[model samples]
Target chain A: MGRVVSAASAIRLDDVTLGYDRHPAVHHLTGEIAPGALLAVVGPNGAGKSTLLKGLVGTLKPLGGRIDRGALKVREIAYLPQAAALDRSFPIDVFDLVSTGLWRRRGLFGGLSKGDRATVAEAIASVGLSGFERRQIGTLSGGQLQRALFARLALQDAAVILLDEPFAAIDAKTVSDLLELVARWRAETRTVVAVLHDLETVRRAFPETLLLARRQVAWGPTSEALRPERLLEARGMQEAFDDHAPVCAVDHAA
Target chain B: MTPYDALVAPFVEFDFMRRALVGSLALSVGSAPIGVFLMLRRMSLAGDAMAHAILPGAAVGFLVAGLSLPAMTIGGLAAGVAVAVLAGLLTRTSVLKEDAALAAFYLLSLALGVTLVSLKGSNVDLLNVLFGSVLALDDDALFLLAGVSSLTLLTLAALYRSLVLECVDPGFLASVSRSGGPTHFVFLGLVVLNLVAGFQALGTLLSVGIMMLPAASAAFWSARLSGMFVAAIAVGALASLFGLLGSYHTGVPSGPAIVLAAGALYLVSIAFGASAGLVWRLLPARRHRAA
Candidate 1:
């Protein structure tokens, strides 16, 4: 029943269950992502949002069931872990960090070719870091560091880009700029899946969405999947509106 | 004769003195890069441990076979690599910290080596192994040092980028398509080889001092990798030359003399070098007052 499909149908997860040390985080999750789609995964704290991305990226193995791609290899996927995941004291420049993306193309001993250098420069420019090639990574600000990591992702030139909470602790301007870049990636017919906590940004940016809270609550277009009833169900609230919770405006287009 | 003239005259006339000076310079240059990586990986103690572990292997070679430097060197390298690999495996499999494993391997090796040397009927040779005599260095030792240093430099130059990447971002390197296993082993092998080759001149105890001190001091001056490598080599070569000359004039042990010279450089770097040094930090404060 598995077959290579068009760009509109790229990743398919069938009955996938994943967890850490036998503790199930995501259970019986079934979904499919289309190419050129901007999908946002949203939930509250400890909602298995990051764990689902880890399972998709092959960093964390699935506990049961199968995660099948139409015809994609693991290397064709690019992952941007949390900003705090990196070692700041490491003595590497922006150029060195970005060049690591080319490791697959230029084996271990092979030097960066002229073409590779051009791609590196283009990727740096794409992230608005044109003159940051020689700057040490430890010297960058939080926003600049996030952009530098985005530059590395651009250099990876993969089909799917998976970002885990890249917008956290960043300023509003940087958030908009990063989302705009993700929109551009979608324009190029690539897949963009981000683990986001801001529901407002999720509604404004991502067309399709997955609402997760230890289990798959809803998986469909943002307008249909992020309804008030579904959100209340996912949040484990009997009453729809509570004094502490903010009201959700669910679009009915889907 | 003036003290300067007396010291200068012996270095010019003595062939053994010339060999000792050149041999120390070559060994310092070869070992410093490996030391840089070792410090970055927080495996500086492992390098120290492996250096000490080679002594028992050397003593065994000397006791079993004739007293041949090459045979001793080969035997020592084998033992050092074995210790490094075992420690690495233990750290991976067990709940032990890397430093704990290193300490255990090194102490056991040292005790075994001393016992083996005592069994060789000449415990006095252990002193020579502990504190080497540069005056006793011969043409064969010079040639061995030169050849090993050249091979190490060539290998480092070839794998420089990958090794640096591995040191800085091992997880990222592992996520990429290239296999990091072989490169990791090659880097470890280079460290083992440098330790074994330089063991004759610096001895086990002081070899790590020469390897680590120069690179550690150089980091205070430069942020660039190539700059750090160049600065480390300069510090190492200068320390070796001055230490050799000072030992010849003052009748001191060559190993301690070299270590003292390196320690002096470290002090100077900490006090005066730019970037991370105390002097640089004080400059902004002075500028604020002056402005």
Candidate 2:
């Protein structure tokens, strides 16, 4: 674990292959992310962008090789999965949900101090949910719910922030406002890894990119990583990878 | 006689009625909050599963000790926890879902309890185990109720925050703290303990009613968890009182009477509760027209 990462590097995946039940979603990926560097994991769908993010966040263990979290301890990294993974019907209010970001410091069963409460309110205001402080989370629209989740991430203040498709299928205004938060996080020198598919947005907002199609295609400046030919090759590679047939006697999944 | 006389006179006259009221009240205070969490977490049926699971343990106690309170209680707690843990394990280790696994285990327990009771006991004794003898609660049963109630309240107060976070977003809680897994198990343990507490007052079949119906009804009224907790306790206490009174007056079985009273509250709440009730949902449009 020690040799796999360093304090200078925020993350190092030494030929890591992430999978479920031994079938690789992300296979044989080697990369070292420097501290304070923002990397956009650009990929086609099913190209293991989320699987890679989950591996980085320590939710999924690497199937082969290793992923050293560098200077980030498990708690120092904040990962937000897709909204569908969250239980929206949960009977919690906006204020309390945002306040849970302070969990790393306060732990479970600890109450918020007066200053901490003010910070939570400020974070809520930052996310444009001021009047919704008391609203039950179940009642919020998808975009508003994302804003509330982003408010929680703001309070987390982790050294490493990982977001899985935070801007997918939402209003443009929400995407822009949340993109601003991402930019602010980068300015603060936090290592931010975002799984992004919108090519134009990725090209405009992200400086560094790692384009993955089950394995590393190209990783460097966004200008080189998202070149048209590389994207076409990624598409071809994924399609060809899917074309191979492994026949089974029954549909076990069904 | 005035309405107050009709309500108050029975308790004033009968010492057994007074004792029954006290026992049910204690059951309400301890178990209602647990019910609220179970409802919010969508583990309401899990509480019922645990309630049924305690039957075999209590039946075994009855078989061995022949109507001793402590023996039955110890047996009930053991059976309840065993079912909870086994169901959890089955869900984890097998393809069976949590609900399916729990249903399988509880049904097995119920069948076992019934068989055990019938083998060595009379029909009257079997009836007592299935529907409790709340009117006949002795000093030992009263002491057990008080003890369980105290333990439930103290444990809940300590675990409330962990339990709430676990309910809302277990994955987030896991990312943040190491307490998530332990909190979940401790909560299940509390569920078993609370079920065992309520079982003596309302038998295995009826005990889960007091826990779930009040909480489900409260969900229609309060959007906030804290508010729902308070609402559930109030609803439970009212159900207990009214059920006890209904039992005394109409000659209905006490345990089922209490459960039916809670069920009645649930139906009323579904129609008239403030938050998501049927009538409540209809009121806004009517008010707008009037305005």
Candidate 3:
């Protein structure tokens, strides 16, 4: 029901080191996400999965390296952070929240035409939330809220979509429904990078996988990257870093 | 005096009371929605800070022009916007949190205001600056208030969608449109302009109460943001009406009387208003959890 975005855009990271306060969160990572690839970013807690997404979205610049956003404008990226990051108590209805996706084409004060309203309604139905259009977002349960967010993303209709732990604390039915939407995006050749914990779902749905633990541990087909030994090694590497480490005096990366 | 004499006679008999009513009504029309946005943005205290921040600028205007309306209004507008802008900048660049930066700037502004007013005038003049002269609003003050109200309503209507998007999902808005920055500054400008207008009627210290309290009270009755906006303006107007009567009958200070009336309304709404009122909590099914 949403507009089709152009395919054939790749994202490349050249030795990117992302961090806060000069203390590296994701260090010395180099990789390329091929055009239209559905990649799952799998890592343990503190493995910098979210940090890498932040880098790709241009929210946080690499402390050392370059990210070449090939063929895709920075505005053509749709990022869905963890549901917890959103303020649920905010007084917004589902329809208005979804319509925010039109801000690019319509602009700040742009009036919504009847056609725009129809498009928003179609996006809401695509996410299985048609009846909840006027419902306040705060009243929704966790699954419903995730559905609303997906509706917003559908309205966004961007080329590159990044989802950070979108399935956390959600029910199985909602997970499957959202997975179907992701599959649809893949069929349309839109690049989808999701930070996921459920390895089984990653193996079943994602074609490519990127394992990160303060660095690139592995990047390949899901089968190759999701091996038990590789997963264990990534977890160990993430946990080994001291949580209380002070800021480094000098950045060793040139 | 009977009830009619107490309530209706003051407004009907005296031109001053009528002028004060017009002044506060204009203030309510503009400032209430600004207050609603502030609460939505979690900037209520920052709104207070900006309110006090206007004082030094208005005092500068007062000193230069001897209680002229336009000078003080312009001065207050500049000061309020400067503080909002500076606080935003400091929060983005430095380690200072937004709340901390706002507190620091407002305290400095308050100190500057006190110093500026004391430099030229006696305590009587100081009283007017701090407490305002609602009953004595001359033609210029009335004109300023009405003009600001018109400007504020027009600006808000233009920026409505963007402003709401900015509050709910700023990250999404930033990704989709470049309008976020200009929308934000415009909203802030309106806030400052409204504060400058409000200072003429309610004074710096008590003016923010008129802006915030009714909006906060409105939240108890309305479920939607738009509903809350209308309810807040209505509540602000109602408070102004009765507050003037209270001042006329009881001889309490006018500005504080208005604020205290709003506060009382807030309390009543918290306990008995429709949306999240305390009466719902006392219902049997809900009372089981409390028990």
Candidate 4:
């Protein structure tokens, strides 16, 4: 019942280097995310999975090489930061919170039309939060809040959707429900990239995977990228990395 | 005393009392909602800091213009915005957090302001700047209060949606639109403007009282932002009315009386309000039927 328009485009990363304080966190990454691609980014803790998503969402600028979005504006990309970044105690309800997704459509001053209200309701129902419309978001459990966030993202109607640990700490039922929504996005030819920890969920739901440990460990089909040896290599690489290392040389665009 | 003799007669007989009531009512409409937003943003004390930050500027204005409304207001606005911007810059560039930076600047500002006020003016003038002369509000001051109230309401209406998004999920708003940072700065400007508006009737020290007391009290009664806004304005207006009357009858300072009235409401709300009030905690939980 929800028909939100999303223009499709491929995202190209040419030796992208993302970092803080000139220190590379996710360095020397190069790849193209084709339109309608459903990809999972897997890594150990501090392996720069979240950093990569930040780079894609344009919150963090690449310290070295460029990320080419072709023609997509940063506003047209939907990003769900980790739950820790959210302030749940702010006084707002489920329906109002979800309607914030229409920011790009309605903008800073435009009022939501009748059709827009119906679309918001549909998005809420799709997330199984039909009756919780008037409930304050602070009262929502983590899973329910995540579902509400997904509903908000659905209304964003963006070409590229990036999520940082979207299913972390979620129940299996909630994870399954959210995954179905992700699949529906893929069916609509929207690009979906998620930072994930659970290998089992990745193997089941994602066809393509980028296994990373501050650098690309493997990038291919999920089965090949998540092989046992590659995972071990990722872990070893993460452990051997020095936290106090000096800034690395900047990459010259090839 | 009869109801008319006690409540109605003070305002009817004394022109100054009527002016005081109208001035504070304007403050209630303009400043209280800003206070609600401040409370929601978890920046309640930040409002207090900003109020103090305006002191040195207003003091300078007083020194130069001898209590001219325009001079003191411009000075107060400049000082408040300068401190806000400086503190914001420090938070961005250094390890100092926004609160710590603001505290440091405002403490110095309060010292400078008081020193400036005491330089040329008498103790009475110092008391006027510190606690306000609400009963002596001139036409210029009244006009300033009304203008600021009208402007604050209009600006808030235009910025409502973005302000909500900025408060609840700043990062999300930053992702989708460029309004997040600009909206926040504008909200801070509104806070300073309201405080400036209130300073004439309530003074720099006590002005924030009218803003914060009612807003914080409203939190006890409601969870919805709209409800909180209504409750806060109601509480503020009631406090202004009673405080002015009480001041006329009791021979106490009017500014503190008004603020104290608001404080009393806040305390009462804490005990008996509808949402998470102390009384609710003391009562037995209501049973919910299983579906």
Best by the DockQ measure: 4
lDDT of 3: 0.86
Write down the C-alpha DockQ for each prediction: 0.34, 0.56, 0.60, 0.78
Order of candidate numbers by lDDT, starting with the best: 4, 3, 2, 1
Q: Name the top TM-score candidate.
A: 4
Candidate 3 Cα misplacement greater than 4 A, ranges:
A2-4, A238-254, B1-3, B285-291
Q: After superposition, how far is residue A232 of candidate 2 from its true place, in Å?
A: 0.4
Which of 1 and 4 is the better model by DockQ? 4
Model 2 DockQ class: medium
Task: Arrange candidates, best DockQ first.
Answer: 4, 3, 2, 1
Which residue segments of model 2 deviate by more than 4 Å?
A1-9, A239-254, B283-291
Measured by TM-score, how close is model 2 to the native structure? 0.93
Second chain alone, TM-score for each candidate: 0.91, 0.94, 0.94, 0.97
Residue B93, model 4, lDDT: 79
Tell me the whole-model lDDT of each prediction, alpha carbons only: 0.79, 0.85, 0.86, 0.90
Tell me how far the alpha carbon of residue A13 in candidate 2 is from the true structure, in angstroms, after superposition.
0.9
Q: Regarding DockQ, does 2 or 3 come out ahead?
A: 3
Per-prediction share of native contacts kept = 0.30, 0.61, 0.61, 0.85
DockQ of 2: 0.56
